[model samples]
Target: MSTQVCIIGAGPSGLLLGQLLHDAGIDAIILERATLEHVLERVRAGVLEQGTVELLERAGVGERMHAEGLVHEGFAITREDEVHHIDLSSLTEGKTVMVYGQTEVTHDLVERRAQTGALSHYQVEAVDPQDFDTDHPHVTCRIGGENIRINCRFIAGCDGFHGASRRAVPESAIRTFEKIYPFGWLGILADVPPASDELIYASHSRGFALCSMRSHSRSRYYIQCNAGDSIEAWSDDQFWDELRRRLPAEMAEAVTTGPSFEKSIAPLRSFVAEPMRFGSLFLVGDAAHIVPPTGAKGLNLAASDVHYLFEGLRAHFLEREDTLLDAYSQRALARAWRAVRFSWWMTTMLHRFPDNAPFENRILETELAYTLESQAAKTALAENYVGLPY
Candidate 1:
């Protein structure tokens, strides 16, 4: 097969990129190792930065999101029983975030792509990108027990951290930095009204907790847990009990808990690979970087990466300009590092270190207190949370 772009993975990043390129009259095909059903079943973050919402609109997939996604102008930060609000809209001059699940975003993109007749192969195996550093790049994969080769001018590596795209790059060509936290987030999805009108991020002596939601009737909550904790170790009752303990008294009492429909523990980490572009291959989203979820930057960072790459491709194909393409990595990385820093800072301030010394605990408490007490600090948080300019 021949196309302008051969995209690996059918996740939001790859699918979003494919849709954007297709709208520009560029030919692209997506390859995925999982079936469509499997993709839709995976749970992910729901927070959307303003830039991400705009990008979805640009791709003609924002109608459902705008109709169903919740908009928030503020969120609360809790220290023990006291709640402090960060007014995002007031601080950022009317900027706000949309609380929409990534799953819905992917579904919209997938449906649009199908309507447009874009090619997508699911359940493919042993996918590999070959000759990405050369003028001619191609991808080889196994589909239905048969080997297939796709030749394209550019290869988009959106298959994520564990995917073959990053591994294809020689070790000497990339420098990676990573930090794994000692704890994980034990999260649950339940069909009940949220505890509050807005999300609440709480820090307690016990640990950190977050109260979020997918809609008015569906709530998602999380509490910090041991890195080695397993789902089997937490029953619905125990999980709810632990979560309520982390929240302030009023919010905890207001929470409505029922049988959880889904439960899992996700480890927190910050990772980045330099030079998102390797010759004809460009990495997008989790393929290039990862941020801790404390600041809700993971999916937003991916959206920004897609924005940069899409602009570069659009310029290359539509305007016959190579300037943006040549500068994709530097531009994406600049914005990416800022988010990484924010996530790291939020994580450090909010999460309780396993062996936190007395001095370190005091410092974290001081930082949180200053953030709540100072307008400048709140503005800074709002700016980063709403997202840095793409």
Candidate 2:
């Protein structure tokens, strides 16, 4: 097979970038190692910043989201039995964040790409970027059980954090920045009404808890757990019990547990690789960086990367400007670093260390108090959570 571009992974970054490139009359093929069903069922980030929604709107994939999505004006920071609210509208000047799943966005892109009759293959095993030529590159892969080779002018490594494509790039040239948190989150998606009108980031002696909703009938809640905690150890009843404990007294019974569609354990970590591009290949989404789930930045950052990567591709293929391609790595790194810093900061603030040291406890309490009492701190968080603006 031969094309102008070859993308690995059918996730949001790859699918959305393919959508943009297809709209620009640029041809590309996406290869995925997992079944479409698996992709559709994967549960991840649910928050979309203002800029991401706008891009989706322009791409015509925003119809379903606009109809079904929940728009929020602000979120609260809770500590010492008091909740400090940051009005996103007041701080960001009219920007709003939408509660929409990354899977839904991928579904929209998949349907739209199918409507356009673009080339996309699922259940592929290997996608190797061979010799690189700036104007022409080659990808070797096995789709289903057959080995196939694809030649292209450019390659997109959107496979994800534990994907084959990222390893294809030599390790010597890549400098990775990473940090691991002492705790992780155990989350459940239940068909219950939400406990609060806004998402709550609660700091308690037990640990960090998040109160968030998925839909009117489906609510998502998370509890801070040991790094090695297992879902099997916590039965449905235990899950609900922990949720009740971590939540404030006022919200003890505000949330109910029902049949849950998804149960997941996500470890907290921040990771980023410098220079998202190497020769004719480029990386996007999880392949380039990963933010801890605390700040709800995973999907939003992936969307932002696709925006810049697609623009860089457009610059090279349509406008004959290679300068943007040369600068793609540096441009993406800037935003990636910012998100890394924010995710780390939020994680450090909200999570409780196992040591339970007196000094660490004071630091956490002090920051939480500042967030609630200081308008400047609240405004800063409001601006970041809403978005960085386009």
Candidate 3:
């Protein structure tokens, strides 16, 4: 089939981009390797940055979120037997984050698209962007051993890190900036009740632990783990013990930890490509860059990047001014790098080093204390955590 824009991957970015284009009366095709059910249920991030929530509300996909998502006021940073809260609500003028998973966001966007009868091709494979001329780009995809081709005015590589999008760029034009941390986070979503109303970023001598609430009843938590540590190695007992270690003695009683529903370790890393666009194929989301999950910046940054891209496209189509369109990559990178910096900062502050380094632990402890006590430090964390300016 032919369309104005052909989007690879039906993740949040790809699907949202299609919806935005459709609203503008522009035609687009979304290709996904996974089934709709799989995409809708793949659990990931839950924190909704202020800008992301606004984008969803504007797109008319946030009614359920408005009713169901939990609004958080602020989060705590704990160290040295003390916990202090950073008032995110006060810092951001009541612009707080919502506890809604990326899975739910995908479901909402999918339902919205389905309401308009815009069908996306699901469970397809071998999506290749080729035959890029100045005027037209062709996306070749395989379905059930059949070679199907999609023609388009432009191709958007919203497919993530594992997809063909990033490597599709010519080697000469690719400038990859990357940093991989020594630690990974073992994230868990439990059926048991949440231990805290707001997130707690605890820098402990043992390691870092984060207790976050998805709802009043559902708990989502994580701890810094060895990159090679298997979830199989950590039983229910071990998880709770770790959670207790991170919690202060008095707060430990308040923390009613529970059984884990989901468990997986994600390595911490920050990476950004110098230029996010290469000819007709423009990359977005994990396809373009990955921020460590510390600052809760991953999903929100993707939403922000594509939001500007849509604005740029609107200007290109409606006003025929390439001002924003020409500046798309630069505009996106401006916001992308800010989140990158914040994520790196959070990662370094929260995660403990393995070396028998009394010095590093002391330094991290001091930093955490400053973050909790100093209004300026708390404000910086709150500002970045709430959302970055678009």
Candidate 4:
């Protein structure tokens, strides 16, 4: 097989990139290690930055999102029993976030790709990108006991952190920085009305909790837990009880709980790999960086990375320009680091450290108190939460 670009994942990043390139009359093929069902089964964050929403619109997949997604102009933060609201729209001059699940986004993109007859090979095994540093790059994989090779001008490594794309790069050539938190988020999805109109982030002596929603009738909630906590350890009643204890009195009373449909614990971490491009191979999304999710930056950061790479590829193929392609890594990294900082700051201020000293705990409390009390601080928080400019 021959194509202009070979994408090594079927996740949102790769799908979005392929859609943008396809719309621009560029040829790209996507390869996935898992089946389509498995891809949509993985639940993830839903907060959408303005830039991401625009990108989806550009890809012709925004109709469902604009129709069904919730627009959040403000969210609340609770310190013990006191609730403080941050008005994102007012603070950012009408900027707002969209609450659309990642699963829905993927489904829309997948359906559009199928309608357009875009090539995506799923349930592939041992996918590898070869000769990415050279002028001629190719991807090799085994699909259904058949060996296939795709020759392309460029290889997009959107296969994520654990995928083969990042591992293909030599250790000496790339630098990585990571911080693994001592806690995890035990999240549940239930069919019930949300506790509030907008998301509520709570910080208490016990830990941190987040009250979020997928739609008007579907609620998603999370509470900080031990790093080794398992889903089997938490029953539906037990989960609701712990969650209610962390919320403010009013929100606790308003929260409607039922049997959870999905439950899991996700470990928190902040990781970034420098210079997202390696020769003809360009890393995007989780393949290049990861955020702790406190500021809802993980998926947004991936969208930004896609924006940068898509522009570069469009320029290279449409305008016959190489400048954007040459600068892809630097441009993506600049925006990525800002989000990383924001996520880290939010996590530090909101989460209780397992062995934090008295002074450290006091400092975190002061930080949160000041952020809630000062208008300038709230504005800064709102702006970042809504998202930074692309």
Candidate 5:
């Protein structure tokens, strides 16, 4: 088979790129190693930056999001028993975030792709992209116990961290920087009203806690835990109790406890592979970078990468210009590094470090204090939280 572009992975990034290319009258096909059920069942970040919201609209998949997603003009940051609000809209000149689950976004995109008759092959195995360095690129994979090859002009790698796309590149060609945090987040999803009207990031003597929601009735809460902690060690009641201990007394009193439907422990890390574009095999989303969920930039960063990559692809195909295509890596990396810094800073400021010296602890305390008390600091946080311009 021959096409203009061959995309790997059926996750949001790959699907979004395919949709955008299709809308532009460009031909592309998506390949996924996992089943359709697996992709849809994965629960991920819910926060949406303004640029992400706009991109979804441009892709014609924002109707359901705008209708069901919560619009948050601000969220709260707490130190000990004190709660301070960061007004995102006022701080960022009428900018706000939307609270919508990543799962729902993927579902909308999947449905739209199906409606448009875009080609997506799920449950394929041994997928590989070859000859990306040359003018002609091709992908080989095993589908239904049969080998297949697809020739294309370019290849897009959206298969994520462990995907074959990045693995196809030689280690000597890519430079990766990574930091593993000493802690992880133990999060649970429950069918109960949120503890507050808006999300809360709390730093207490014990640890860090976050109060977030998937909707008005479904709450997603998390608390810092040991990096090696096991989910079996935590019960529904125990998780709720620990979360309450880290929140303010009033907010704790308002937390509605119930059996959790989903629970997991995710280790925090900041990772970035420099030069997101490896010849014609352009790495998008998790294939390129990862941030601690503290800043809620995981999915948003992926969307931004998609935005840059789409623009580059559009220029190359429609206008026969390679300027945007050549600059994809530089442009995406600039924004990605900024987010990585913000996520690292937020994670450090909000979490209790096990190896912190007495002076370092004092500095972290002061950092939160100053951020809440000073307008300049608050504006900086709001700007990064709402997202930097794409």
Candidate 6:
């Protein structure tokens, strides 16, 4: 098989890129190692930056999102028992974020891709991109018992951190930076009304806790835990009790406890692989970088990457230009590093460190205090929260 672009992974980044390419009358194929059902079943963050929203709208998949997703003009942060709200709309001149799950976004993209009759192969094995360094590039994989080879002008590696695309690169050619936090987030999804109108992030003596919602009736909550903590260690009742202890009294009382439908503990980490391009192969989304979920940049960063690559490819195919394509790595990394810094800052401010010196802990306290009290600081936080410009 021959195509203009071959995309690895059926996640949002791959699907969104394929959709944009298709709309431009470009031919591309997507390969996924997991089944369609598995891709849609994975749970992820739901905050959308304005850039992500506009990109989804451009792909013709924003109808459901605009209809069902919650619009958050602001969110709250608490230090101990004191609650402070950051008015995103006011601070950022009416910019706001949409609370839509990443799964739903993937589902919309997948459905749209299917409707377009595009080529997408799910449940493939041993997918590999070869000769990306040269003009001629191709991908080889196995479907069922049949071996397959696809020739393409370019390859997009969206298969995420552990996928074959990044692994395909020679270690000597790539440099990675990472910092693992001392704690993880123990989170749960439950069928109950949200404890507050907007998301609440709390920093307490016990730990950091976040009260968020999937919808008006479905709440998603998280509390910080030791890095080595197990999901099985905490029962539903215990999780709720612990969460309430971290939140301010008023917000805690508003929480409506119920049986949790999903539970997991995820370790926090910030990772970035520099220069997202390797000849004809471009690393998109998690393949290039990863941020702790504190600032909700995981999927947004992926969408921004799609935006840059899509523009580059569009210009290359439609106008016969390679400038954007050549600058893809530099442009994408510039925005990605800013997000990484924001996520790292937020994580440091809100979570308790196991071995921080007393002075360092006091500095964190002062940081939060100043951020809430100073208008300029709040505006900076709000602007970053709503998202930096594309």
The per-prediction CA RMSD against the true structure, in angstroms, equals: 0.7, 1.3, 1.6, 0.6, 0.7, 0.6
The CA lDDT of each predicted structure is 0.94, 0.84, 0.84, 0.95, 0.95, 0.95
Residue 26, candidate 2: Cα error in Å is 0.7
What is model 1's C-alpha RMSD?
Answer: 0.7
- TM-score for each model: 0.99, 0.97, 0.96, 0.99, 0.99, 0.99
Candidate 3 lDDT over residue span 14-116, tens digit each: 9888888888877888999998889987888899998899888776798999898989998887773778778899977787889888888999999999998
lDDT of 5 by residue, 301-337 (tens): 9999999999999999999999989999999999999
Candidate 4 per-residue C-alpha lDDT over 124-150 given as tens digits, one digit per residue, 9 for 90 to 100: 999989999999899999988899998
In model 6, pairs of residues that clash are none
lDDT of 2 at 125: 81
Over the full model, what C-alpha lDDT does candidate 1 score relative to the true structure?
A: 0.94
Tell me which of candidates 1 and 2 scores higher on lDDT: 1
Regions of candidate 5 where Cα sits further than 4 Å from its true position: none
Model 2 agreement with the true structure over 7-122: per-residue lDDT tens digits: 99899888888888998899999999899999888887788998889878766699999998899999876763666777888887888899987878888988999999999998
Residue-level lDDT of model 6, residues 290-358, one tens digit each, is 999999999999999999999999999999999999999999999999999999999999899999999
Worst 10 residues of 4 by lDDT: 136-145
Give model 1's TM-score versus the native structure.
0.99
Residue 77, candidate 4: Cα error in Å is 0.2
Distance (Å) between predicted and true CA of 188, model 5? 0.5
Candidate 5 TM-score versus the reference: 0.99
